[model samples]
Target: MTEGRDDRGVAQTGSNARKVFIKTYGCQMNVYDSQRMGDALGSDGYQPTETMEDADLILLNTCHIREKAAEKIYSELGRIRLLKAERANEGRELRVGVAGCVAQAEGHEIIARAPAVDLVIGPQTYHRLPQALAKVARGERVVDIDHAVEDKFDHLPASQAGQIRGRGVAAFLTVQEGCDKFCTFCVVPYTRGAEVSRPLAQILEEARRLVAAGVREITLLGQNVNAWESSDAQGRAIGLGGLVRQLAEIPNLLRLRYTTSHPRDMDDALIAAHRDLPALMPYLHLPVQSGSDRILKAMNRRHTAADYLRLLDRIRAARPDIALSGDFIVGFPGETDADFEDTLTLIREVGYASAFSFKYSPRPGTPGATMEGHVDEGVKDERLQHLQALLRDQQAAFARAQVGRRMPVLIEKHGRHPGQMIGRSPFLIPVVLPASAGAIGAVAEVRIESVRPNSLMAEGAEAMPEAMRLRA
Candidate 1:
């Protein structure tokens, strides 16, 4: 039997603290979600363990963005089920739980198929994890995917920012959740619910806490991050740009970034933030799913090729040095040879620093799932290969451009070699340099010596003076 609950509904320990192992897969927001889940369980006397074998409880924080995500979950669950039996024979109880988008989408199905899973909590409902675990301890199989009426963020305990930042110098902080733009290929709206921006006070408090805990950089996250809107301390409604300006006010936060933006929501003020906020990193990931006007219409993108280019022009006008990344779906339903070529033309026109490209996979319940003219498997494979090749070349070119340039890098971790440490350029390219763990969290000057397809090789600026370096 466990100790009784407290006034806050936190689960009390029976005698010793339990260990929880979480395997997170998906977007940066999911990473933030997993960290918050760990925080929620922290009050329940549960500590995190990296090793599955040593864990008393295991949670799979899943993603449903790609195809066969559910199948992947079941496959992993099978392995966990066997582990549970093995633990039972050893007279140890192993409770399994599933959380996040997959859990939200397939709650009843998951529990019915895998009886070993003790609980299924949605992405939004994880704030009540301790109470859910309490139910599981009482032999009740709990599946709570319903959207909580109460604010989940308000209920979650303050993050152990220092402890979490110890895992990484940079951290992901989600200021918004869900999506209102139901992209034909996305399951976010269905799984994550409607877009809701956290209040300004809550976001600022979290950022301050992270900074207090030794974090030097934070990447703001959301499905549509630029869509975020909240009131100021004075209750004046403001957009994501305003929120970013406020965050940049934190004394110790060295770098700031935000991602997964939509072109439609790229307001004037947010675009201006890129130019105005010195702390904001000069990289943006704006997804333009298709380039063909016909396909964009079919996808309900609402923005045309011309509109996207105009938006890009405005953004470049605001911040000339801003590096851009984009999301592309090559084989969407009804895409023709002309459409594909148009996409290639756009790629050449925009000259992407780096971007993500994927073959279109129809998500269940999304309009695309039932749409006619699904591209053949071979065609999708071929198109995806072609798109990736172009993206690779562009990315390589961007990396090559950095050689001989003195750039500032925020060190993130130790490199593969003894004297090497790794960090990222403002363009988000990982760079390997000569340093130790002591360099982590410090943004230092480095001169790029060599460039690879994926990373840059660099030397300390003091070691390689400007006069000795080769110019691009």
Candidate 2:
């Protein structure tokens, strides 16, 4: 049972339930982790609160994927520090904690730097958050970053049924965690540890619970999501493709998707699943960090530009309407004008529906950091602008092409206007149309009427008949 709040909407101090405010940073996986952390703390009489000011404990679930993301955590801590002090002055107790990759990477340093942080728990050890909080209650600062011996997932309690329904129709379920590839410019392998796939039974159990809670869509998540592999009930080994096929069997699961794939892990069985699974969305986010062979070699991606293109060719052949997305990095060490052009050439060749491009920043302890002939910031900036402009054009073109097409859209939430509602297309594009609040969790077919800068406009299908819509 949840604790009662006062008429002013603030949690009462005398209430048995303590409120926790979690600020999640980076990735769908972090979102999943935050929810699990809440579940873990739920056992200790804590409930979630949106407003940090009313929180008895505040957690910053951080990401250390990039240098900027890591530094941003510290910047946020500075603001939280003031809030903690203010709450203390009022004689109200407020505890601050940091969790996730940044905590794993620099555990001791974070506690030393931010005196306000009472507990620091890493991604692998967050299942022990209740125990860590106990230590903090004894007037001790706690740092738990060790790769625990027991499986964290096995220890985590299932989210309360009400909590699951409150998360909305679309949800993220982490089937895998960590990385083993160890790319030169990456920190995931170090911070998240080696690759590990959750047992198939555990995943199915969770997926079933999600569906039971009215979740219509589930995006399987991981550091390298496509790399997930586990054995079936008969003890037969299966990969992500097999997992998707199994998940599609769950009744009322209208949409299935996974993200942040590695090029090397795009096996033939997974491609076949794309062709066969109707519930799987026609979108993929596979990161091919660079197009130049030299840069790819230096980065230890182990796959060349041609190899990536060939893989895409096979994938596109399997699912003709699949919208392609990729990740690109500009100005890696020793990258030249020709190397940058090669990236542009590849981008044009693939014609990405959408992509993420960044000016490369060196991460400490990664091989690329100490590599020779790092490009100038001015050049990185120039190349990034050029790449982004191209990607924007492609995205705009893709949006334009979708105009006049009829497609199924999963109504996610109510839009800004009273009658307006937003839904996600099969290609993962946001489509806004007039819809009733009752239609929020239904999948309706709508004709794309026009294109907005960031979303598609739909019409002529608002009054969806009971038979036409799949209600959650």
Candidate 3:
């Protein structure tokens, strides 16, 4: 773990500057938020430390998606109590704070349950962290759960604003935040608040920064990425498709992608982007959640099975080579045998290259959690296993089809096996090849030799001399 200490509004003694540690709980958005928090505090002279034991301030960046995410955070706080006590015995002050979804969900209750916690700030209120920390230093307990309507990105710097410590071939750029869809089983609308997007100029600026920093691929991120809408600084409207077109113009950017789109938001412009932008990866992760119209209506997903199928047709028509990925919930409230079969039928129709399926786990305060007719645990487990097996078979078939074909892979890092390197194809398929250490972060043309259950084994093609040239 890396360790560093700095001063934020506190007197800087050469050896006693305070260190801040943030432990993130769930989702890519939370991971991004944690990084932003680190950058924000870094500007105020606070450095990030990986471990809690050696930090003056410890913050838990939480998630409330899973059933026991809050309880898990509380348990971790309990463990940290002893560390705080030990530090206090040594005449040192250690402050603990809670941030993110659980902080938004539980509010001051987290402070009540864990009295050692000096600050509790929600995801939307992260911009006020410096003020909260200042109050904590004065022996005051602080809680901020207010959600603002304006852009939070304005208060913070660019997502990539900091010293570049390392390089990667791919990066995730957040173009939007929050969701308004409010799927009954989802807690995002409540935890993350309403939908909001950054201005087009800011997004383009961030993309250019990442490209300058050596990123070859960028995946635009949001809870409902396809629902993205924003204007430029001049008040010109821009959607996800417009954003893609602008980003594709950046020199040296080889690929683009987006994720977790709503079926209702799959418009003509976005489909056109898929057809027009050659650098856009030939893959889509459109999460339908359930195939039964009854279940879909009950979950407030708004789109029907027929609607999803029609959208799928549009996507495939735009890019026939595109591989599909999806999400499913097996036992949503009031779901029956017919409903589960409907989902199975949809899966077979879509033939997903990969998928994520989970049994319905009710989240507190969500509409579905309070609904009646919860499926039996035994039935839910059985359906989950069956769905997973079918998905595995489909993915295996997709991988096998890749054999004897050539793909462009962006090598990311060295694999655990000696002389082996790992990379991902444009469709996000993992490729393992034997290459030199210097090949990391370079694109190579590999001929598929064999297909495993989840990945492909390949070698550099001799026909393409460029494929064999390892970068130094």
Write down the lDDT of every candidate, Cα atoms only.
Answer: 0.86, 0.89, 0.83
Model 3 per-residue lDDT tens digits across residues 1-472:
3333333454564455568899988877787688778777765667667678878889899999887888899899999998999988999888999999999989989989998899999888787788788787777899998877546767754443343224377777777888999999999999888988877888888788888887888888898988889885678887899889989999988889998798898899999999989888899999999889999999999999999999999989999999999999988999999999999999999999999888899998899999999999999999999999999999999998899988888888776555678889777998887675248768888788887556788864222234333321
| Candidate 2 pairs with clashing backbones | none
Candidate 1 lDDT over 1-472, as tens digits, reads 4343433555666655578899999888888889888888876767788998888899999999988999999999999999999999999899999999999999899999997899999998999898899888888999999874766666766776545666477889888888988878889999999988888998898888888877888999999989999888788999999999999999989899998799999999998898899889989999897789999999888899999999999999999988989999988999998999999988888989989888999888899999999999899999999988998888888888889999889988876655668899998998888774247889978889887657888864223444433431
Q: Compute the lDDT for candidate 2.
A: 0.89
Better of 2 and 3 by lDDT: 2
Best by lDDT: 2
- Candidate 2 lDDT over 257-375, as tens digits, reads 99979999999999999999999999999999888999999999999999999999999999999999999999999999999999999999999999988888988889989999999
Against the correct fold, how does model 2 do in TM-score? 0.94
Q: How are the candidates ranked when ordered by lDDT, highest leading?
A: 2, 1, 3
Runs in model 2 deviating more than 4 A are: 4-16, 436-438, 460-472
Task: Give each model's clash number.
Answer: 0, 0, 0
Score every model by TM-score: 0.93, 0.94, 0.92
- The model with the greater TM-score, 2 or 3, is 2
